[model samples]
Target: MSSAMDIPKGRASYKKKDGILTLTDDRTFLIWSPMPANGPPTVSLALDKILNLKQTPDTSPKVILKIIEKPKNPDEQEGQSFMFQFTSPTDARTEANALRDLLSQLLAEIRGGDPNVPKPLGAAGGPSAAGGPPPNAKPPSNRWYDDDSLKADTQLQQSLLDKDLELAKTHAQALALKSDSISDESFNKQFWSSRVGLLRAHAFEQHQKKGSYNVLSTVKPRAENGEFKLSLSPEQIQSILHQHPLVRRIYNENVPKLSEPEFWSRFFLSKLAKQLRGERITDVDNSDPLFDRYLGADNSLGVASKITAAQHVPHIIDLEGNEENQGGFKSGNRKDAEMRPRANIPIIKTLNSLSEKIMADVAPADLEPSGTPESGAKSFDDARVFNQLSLQDLHGEREAGSIRLNVKDQTKFFSNHGDGISGEDAQIYAQQNPEDVLFEVVADLDTFDDDGAGGIDLRKSIGVDDDSESDHYEDATMSGIQKTPHVGSRAARRAAEQQILEGLRKARAEHAGGPTGANAVEASPMGIPPDLTERCYLTQMTTTEFLKQFWSAFLSSSSSGDSSEGGSAAAAAAAAAGELAYHVESLKRCVERIEAIAAEAERDRLRAAEARKKQIQEHYQKTGKKLKWVPPKGGRDSVMALFEHTTAAIEKAVALYRGSRG
Candidate 1:
């Protein structure tokens, strides 16, 4: 009572929101405390400290979500305590540990039939989740484990209950405690078990020591001993029976199932009908009369001494006749027997075996053809008759269709891994997917043009050879200019455009030979320069638009000249017909070079991959990575396309550089 009173007094209220102790009334108190052996009793203070409150409600120990109002009975007001709940995680472990120690001490004092024990925490109130015995402690085998409201074993968890893993653990704990406990009853049981074990062990040892002997209490076997009697004691009989091959085998065959008494009774000492029990002799009992001729005054000694007298007989035969042939054994009485000749006839013996004899006399004639073509056989004794086949094709099947095979030998296929892929691709194909490979080749063209009007194919783009003959174009106009920093420097490009306008005017006024011979220089009449060619660089008009315009203009002109010439001699017609002549060769070369670059990139990729593989191999060799799987025998494509993004960048750069030239 002194220890219990040491606790502080308070209302022991908790926050309705998070169970935080607000110390609203400070009526906290302990109901019990622990007194240790030889040490001062521990004092418990139920202080409303709220020492380890969580910043958030989630961190607090879960209890009931209190939604009800305060009780109307003022004196009986008591909140459902959270003694059932785990303390906040932020709580000091030392404090929680101390509580457990106090509870255990209280339990120990109240247990073991102690009459002065206080009521358990659950018995006083309804029940404390932490303070009461575990709900699973006294469950029935079936229904107790099948409750739905409880979280123990719903349908989801029924498998665990069925396995009885928890029950097994309980049984294991009990077994451990039982093993630790010592008692006289346990000792007696152990003693009896040990005694029985020793008896069986000694019995086996004696059997082994005597080489072989019957331990089962069976009977002695009756046996023949000529005409007289002969028998041994049970031990001697057992020794003999143990040594007998067949008898020992029977005993070994049945000993594991047989009881000691029944084994010997049925096997060793069985009695035969119409026979004296355990007797070994069939001779008459009247030995005295049988040996009377040799018996002396001492009948026993005389009977033994004349053992061979039993062979004597009392009959004889004599033969007599005139002129008898006398044998060496008897001369006084003899008779002559008449002689008769025995006939002998030759036998016609049936043939038992005709091995070489039949073969030498007979040969088989050729039979009807089987319609099946006979092929590949060079001689009659061609021993190679069976067709060769892959085991994969015939593993579960009996025979393949009888088509003649081109190859008659077996072959083996292998990959980086050891699994061979001979006969079929089944095992190999599953390891890789077809989508994981490079398929499309890169496209290449000799030149890039960007103009609305179809432009002439750049001579440099197709690697032009020097051919200075200018007669191909009659009365054609051409313009040339130096662009290396104009000396006058007052917008020289403007002067160039003005020169083009002035040249057109002069040509139209007949200052130059005709408008057909039109030309321009760095000056025009009005001096308005072409701004786009310099301000914005362009290599060519967009090729697709340029082609449409150029083809239409050229066809219109050629049609006015001659109808047949429009289709035959027209420039558009020639250009279209000579597509191969203009760019195909250069495009082919460009493609070859691009392909070479791709191959180089592929090689580099492979080299890097090989280096990575070496690094991984070294790591695995050192650490034995434990999951070093042997890759299956094959894959779809050996290489994968890695669109490096650099080619796109290069193409963009080329386009940029080309756009700079007017």
Candidate 2:
């Protein structure tokens, strides 16, 4: 029977009769009973659907359950109750009571409340000390399962209803604002109004794709097995046509006569293609008879010159214009060994045209014009560009100068140790200074007298003979059986050691009394005074401000055209002359300031040197030892070095201004 019931492996059958009854993990009450000859037998109900449960008090306790069943149609009334009865006697009453309590708890949990609350069944039906309901007592209410008042507070329901109403009202208001009809004009206007964001995204995408590959460079013929083939994508073809309009014109003129593949094959072999790719072309290169004729077409159109003229670059960076100003000397010459002029006129024009087209396509549409008519149309000749090219700060006067480093103790500045020199380091320095040792060795060598033989007698001079020294060592080795080898005579060895020690001592003494010594005379302070430094800074800043103003006025006047043309031109020329005079005055003042600072620094240097000399004499008297002193090298003071450059620049500016005035 258990096998027939298909009971799951772990679930226990709470009751077994003609069949078994079990509750699944999912809270479904399952019953399997033996069927009549004509009917199917099992019934299942979810525990949550149970409306009421009762246990009869008879010897054969009857467990009665009223459960709500699902309706066939959604619109039909819900909570259609069905009755179920299970009869077993003796042990069934206790089991039924336990099952009733469990069902109540599970139902309470499913319905959301404390499980300890009394069940919906009457007091008599409950499992507490109070018994089951009277047999004649009517059921409480037919609509008990549908009454939400029994489950939740009235206030909560009202609040939820109000929220739902508010949400509906908001939705209705939004719907009322929406137009019922959408016209073509309105749709177009709306789309175009919001298209800026889309256009920006598209432009960004295009810009990312632009530098990936050069169309002309990538279109090369490949050698296959016994054949040459060139394949171009649609995009590559369109790009080539756009970049090289001359090539496109030739293609259009010749494509009808020749097939597309033949046209491409001939085009790739032509000198025109090589020129377009910026490759050097000679008479030796393979040329197409058909496309060779179109080589001069780009030059005739003058596209390169036109494109160059259209560029709005500043004068500082315009190399072509500078070359023109220099009488086209570089353009005419072919002297550079490393970078030979490989690109011919046609190739240059093609490249320029291609660059112009590419820039026009990629540049933003809403950009303001770089040059305006009212500003003399000077293009990019603005203060920002001038400052950037000249490496000058635009607002240098506003920026604070760096803090000066004031080191109080000059001795500590050059000390090897932080506070003073260490004895160990001094010894190392003495040993490293080989000058004394070298001089002593040289003197000893000079004293050697020539022997009768070709070489001087080194052993005689040192008072050691090779044979006696060897014999002495041999006798000593035999007598004591010693392993120590004979190096040299003890006297000669002692003399050499004494010489080395003396040289080291002399070197240490010199190092202790040198300029870097602890008691050495301090040099005069070498830096400019704070007040002088501040004055220099202010002068330079004033000069820079005047220079900027002068340049602006000069450019404005020059670009305004001939002063003979109108009263405005004459007025601009007068203003420019005034700015020129102001600028010249500022330059002169700046040069004077620089010279004054230099003169002051020179005087300070002389005073410091004199003071240093006096201190050195005082030091010699106190210590009874003369310290080694090196005089400061004579040269132009660093401050005066800038004076020459400043004067030269001022002179050039004056000459240029005079020439312009003439």
Best by lDDT: 2
Q: Write the per-residue lDDT of candidate 2 for residues 97-208, one digit (tens) a residue.
A: 5555566666766543222244455543534455655523434542223333222333333333355554334323323332335333332233223233433333344336
Worst 10 residues of 2 by lDDT: 32-41
Which candidate number has the best TM-score? 2
Candidate 1 TM-score, C-alpha based: 0.12
Per-candidate TM equals 0.12, 0.26
TM-score of 2: 0.26
